[model samples]
Target: MGIITAGKYEGQHPIHPKARQILLDAFDQGWADPTQISSQGRQAQALLDQARESIAKSLGLKVDEIELWGEPELISPIAIWGAPGFGVSPFIYGATERSEIIGMRGKSKQFFEISVDIDGAIDLELLTQTLQPNSIVAIQSANIETGVIQNIKAIAKAVVAQNAHLHIDATASGARFVKPSYWSTLHFDARSWNGPSGVGVFALKNGARWSNPLPHTRPTRAPNSFSIPLALAAASALEHWIADEAANSTRLKSLIERVRNHVKQTISDVDIAGNAESTLPNIISLSFLNVSSEQLVAELEIEGFSVASGSACVASALEPSHVLKAMGLLTHGNMRINLNHDVQDGEITKLLALLPGIISKLREN
Candidate 1:
């Protein structure tokens, strides 16, 4: 079998074919600085605005409420900063949220960690109890590594009842599911939706209390920062995804479920993260007892398959997955399967056939 991409395309998936075409066509049109007062610049500005409108329509937002960033790293902190409260707002987030989002906790502000159960579901009751009126709560719409989905609407309800704000990190599962209707601020990576790299999108809900977290003279809420071609590509891919979402999502969900069931029934002493009923349909996180993820990933690579082995965000660091550890699952021997929307059942079947023997041999060694 040929090498297959099981890595969830979030941030890593290549641009969709139609989106790639849009990107190529946009290069000439979007090359000029949209801020400039030239004819070419006006064309670029038009392309940028059109892209934003397309994305807005897909996500159910007005064009003015959205902003694009060329950098993904700073989106979380910046989005959190622009929320209802920043320096004074006591923040609370799930234990499994991305480091960038949770890292903001110690800007010398009060914070709380919403605990997750073994399945990586955050404690909703405890979260409600932790709410402080006029506070800010940061949370993941879905876990990137475990594919666990949160009851953010319920959390949002609690936050709103307390007169607080909600910042949702939908980077992992954005565009795969319906966009949440309730949020003070929302952040998503363009890469999450089969777009080019180095682009992220965020929105401050209309009438939501927000301000520029960074120093800027521009009246726009965000820096108006991003590659114009890439932004168009991202928006185009989102449209394609939305059009095909129902079928694609159902297929991806079925594939992940197959992988989950096979690993549990065939592989001994394996731990699977996330509950099938509540998790995203596209990702599966599995860990085998007494096996090394690094070694497993290498072996799988040699077998013409590529799977993620650690926290997706920090995989290059070769660190233990904070999410698995937080959920009390085996942090070692972890394998994450991110189903590409177009992946074949044969590919998964091949992967399934290889996993049992590979795990057995690794455990024996």
Candidate 2:
């Protein structure tokens, strides 16, 4: 039930079935080094270009602007910290930004972290006040665990007024939550569209003031290290998602709202962590007072359901979720649900029916 379950936020989504075949086909035809001058090399290069072109069309970016970075985790540092400008600019970001972006703070010349409210929206006034002409800002369009979306439009306006660069981490929501015109650099995860992992795509807007921080012989060198077949798979997945899953998004949103409402009405002392109106459709976060998230997760598993805990422990310690902590929400007794295309409405109904009893039983102990 790993990829088959509704609890899909944890690991690599199994590559879309159609994309899997495309990957196999690509390996057959695209295995040669695209940089070589042989006939086979030209064919492989053509396929790679097509892959980039397909993904670029999906993201509303030019073909030349995209890079096929090998790892999603590494792309953050490459796009954000790799910029020479960030070294001297005033760094402004919400405290709830992903660990990859936040971890770069020590290197910034001047940085300010604006705290988020209970709903996980970045503080607008404080953020606006902090922006400078050479400011560098990193903001996630939505939180991965809690699905809280920031007001990118308003944030971008402030940054633009001060002639600052904005790095938008659209890893959680992808193009659905992004505004291309507002970003100096934009990143998206192929895995978000059930594409292959390690196929992270980041775009450099034309005329952006940045260069590869990675050491290179030439000052104008760029990096492209991902597998060509995987790039094809990622593009295929995006096409499949746009054709098949985008239409179902509305129905899923409706079901998600019903879960939020049902849980709120039937349970007490439960903190629904994100703003209902502004969050991503595929993720939900809930915290039950007086219950162990570990217990709830285990109990739900026993009942043939799969769910994850917010602040999932690492190295045997219950790591606090920076998103929840920054929002001043409960850090424990939390459960996160991530819906996939295969998760049926019936499964949602069943989970809704099972939650109250399992939660009560866990609390009673």
Candidate 3:
């Protein structure tokens, strides 16, 4: 099949050619333990430090504040509830947050979800009312499914006014958006920006009032010894993403609007989710009137175009998307399209050309 499914999900991008070369070149030293004092270990330590410094520079953070790990899902809980010495405080998140954030309910001291407007933005008024001193407020820079960017600066200000901490998940935003200066903590996945998988970075601002929640006998608090080559590759990929950010954003925004406008004009009983004015240029979530998301996905696949029926993070789930539900949008027949950073204009045009006929056929039957 001549398939084009770029932006299928996070880390789904084929490793950048430059990142692959970096990984290969560092393969030997990457295997050595950076903590050991041996010569080889010292070389590995140099590589690791370089990688960390590169990432820190990219995020505008100090080197010591960065922690490298594999899982993006685990970062939220650890940052929100695991900090040692910090007393359990209320955990608040937007209703449109990833399931992982919403799932923190049982694990937190007291978890609450703030409502989102139709555009999938956190209701700032409700959030203000819900804040408690020492509370941990988790908000993503951008919604993975809807691509709605949050007002993190405002949110962080409110959280701080209440003497609470804010954790911003920049995984979906990657290098596309800058972190708010007032954010207490932030995290991003390497794979989100066309880097290799199996690496993620978490950053805690100095004086952020967080400690490792996990019982620690080890000198280091990070859970895993990540692959040094992977870290280097990730940093390299991030550099490239940042360099291309402006052009990519402009091109992708134009292409996304093309599809959005075409679908609205040609299709029946359709609703486009998220506020276009405040969303990432890459992702769009659409709902159909009488189509089964599964069947529509299958049909699209047969046509050599791969699309997601719901959130890529929870594609295996049978229930409707929590993001759409929170926004009071139709949850059934939902499809999320994420345009790849390198996607061509022709690819988008091709998809738009096919959608009307495919959707009409599906609805008629």
Candidate 4:
């Protein structure tokens, strides 16, 4: 029923009426270049000011430290590229948290990847063992596909011990899942939080230096200034989503547990993937024995249940999910249930009812 397949505002097909009007008003008020000082420019400037203020509050940071970008993917490569010739090997997560990062690699002057554990979290021991002089470490705070929560505070400690510059990609790091202030406490040099997708918040801690991917004159270097409107909307959504996270998480977790229990009781060989306790409350990845994830997804869709086999962003690819592969799990027949803000226990129950029968039928093939 939803147009966008991810994020806080999932399942609401049309834009939220209030959020839509907010964007409309913002657009009407910001029709000119904010860099100018004319009447229209002043209006744009005011809109941008409000936008930055809202985003900064969402990320627990001052407005100036948060660099707003339309595309969130630009943050890491930009930061890595901008660093003053470290001559040190950079340590990237064995896997990228976002799809865009795949395209962003190799452009940087130098870097290496650290392997993640079976749960898709980077191994702490391996990370500590690999520490060396002039190491630039990039770790995603939360994994997007497996919903595996990394020990950022612990990893940050390790990074600091090695005197490395740590850049966090908190792209899908849900506010309820990870707090921005905690990253601040860890002293991350520059961290990029995909302020709920279309809104990218690149926070450079005070006295931190990083390079911008786009090269323009010093005074005019913003990639997309009009992104202010999207940022405002995302900030509004984030605040609304996070405030209710505790209750929602509890509710969703209960529903997922029920689903997991039901599958375990009814289906003999199905594997419920992902970290049981440390994963995001909204995501559950399960694989039915001897079935294709593609087949299961299609069958579920036919039954009027919309979900993903893996990462929804890359579901259509022929290869199995990289996240599942990283986790050392069976990639076949993997179905990822992503609960939305509005999804209820009743919906989970209904899906559970249909799941076993479908699995039985699919496996007969």
Point to the candidate with the largest TM-score: 2
State residue 89's C-alpha deviation in candidate 3, in Å: 1.7
Q: Candidates sorted by lDDT, descending order?
A: 1, 2, 3, 4
- Give residue 161's error in model 4 in angstroms: 0.4
> Model 4, 1-365: lDDT tens per residue?
42112322232223444555666776766566667679887876776688678667766677777776665556566655554443335545456345445444565456566667666777788888877646666677766555667888788788678666667766555454344333321111111122234555667766654555466777532466536566666666655655556557688778777877888899988767656777766667787778876778777777778766663333667666767776777777877676665666666777888889999998998
The sequence of per-residue lDDT tens digits that candidate 3 reaches over residues 238-282 is 787777666678888988898889998999898798767888888
Q: Against the hidden true structure, what lDDT does model 4 obtain? A: 0.61
Clashing pairs in 4: 118-327, 293-333
lDDT of 2 at 228: 84
| Model 2: per-residue Cα lDDT over 257-355, one tens digit each | 988999999999988978789899878889888888888877788777777676545114457777778888888788888777767788788888989
TM-score of each: 0.94, 0.95, 0.93, 0.85
Candidate 4 accuracy as TM-score: 0.85
Clashes of 4: 2
* Root-mean-square deviation of every model: 2.1, 1.9, 2.2, 4.1
- Model 2's number of clashes is 0
Q: Score residue 26 of candidate 1 by CA lDDT.
A: 82
